[model samples]
Target: MDGDEQLLRGRVYGHDHDDPDPGPKAGRTYAELVGGPLDGLLLDIHGWRTEEVDDGVALTTELSRWPGGRALYDPRPGEPRAAGPGIACRFYYSGDTP
Candidate 1:
């Protein structure tokens, strides 16, 4: 496929780079990213566990300082919605992962 096509299918953090208005996809649930560089990004949590969502997750992003690096994202201070609807929760970008 072409670059644009690849970007659509290879989205990270639920963001389609080519799409102007990227948000939570229909029929799919996601967690909205809050602070840091990855703010406003959505993370798909189709089959995540409570601990995984409560603890946090590391998301791969090209925006990291190092190549193929991942960014640490944690849920909001008091909003741990592992069973919420649509945008289940919000994960804030903490830092880059080694």
Candidate 2:
């Protein structure tokens, strides 16, 4: 389980929007920032709403972006399946899926 947990804490190489002149920098993604693996992602939307940009198909297809691994997606209501054991907290993954 610890190894699986480790999967969530990997640094990835991607573009950072906040940086005006953001060069190539490997930073931890939302999932990775929370300690998720490259593909060990968990996309949990507040409503998993349907949209032209992020439809279920598009969301599922996004998984392909992963190098080579599976993502644990949970698009439930406002609350994720399990934010954390014995923890009373909630998280919503918005346009920050990448």
Candidate 3:
């Protein structure tokens, strides 16, 4: 991985059960991710080379359609603390093991 890729990789916060507070802030609101209008919103999942709409409602609905997949919110760093952090959705798929 190159320097830029490494920096972007550093932004991704993988699932951590032990640590209560992962480095990135959890996105709880749609407005937090997309600034103003929801139209033409795009989400990019680093390393995975995938992008989707940055809509909370749409994402939640889509997540439920997946058999064993779920979505998570990971905030970006070095933004205005008060304005709330920008979020990137991370989806995880665990094969049927129930």
In order, what lDDT does every prediction score? 0.67, 0.31, 0.30
Off by over 4 Å in 3: 1-31, 34-61, 64-68, 83-98
lDDT of 1 by residue, 14-38 (tens): 4568877565555566776667657
Spell out the clash pairs found in candidate 1: none
CA shift at 9, candidate 2, in angstroms? 2.6
Q: Provide the clashing-pair count of each candidate structure.
A: 0, 7, 0
lDDT of 2: 0.31
Best by TM-score: 1
lDDT of 3 at 24: 37
Each model's RMSD to truth, in Å? Answer: 7.9, 10.6, 13.5
- Model 2 lDDT tens row, 1-98: 67534543332224333546432222312322222332333232323323411222223233343544332332335533333322112222332233
Minimum summed lDDT over a 10-residue window in model 1 is located at 3-12
Worst-scoring 10-residue span by lDDT in model 3: 29-38
Runs in model 1 deviating more than 4 A are 1-15, 19-23, 80-84
Residues 1-98, candidate 3: write the lDDT tens digits: 77323323222223243555433334421122232222223333323322232222223323233534333333343332222233334222222211
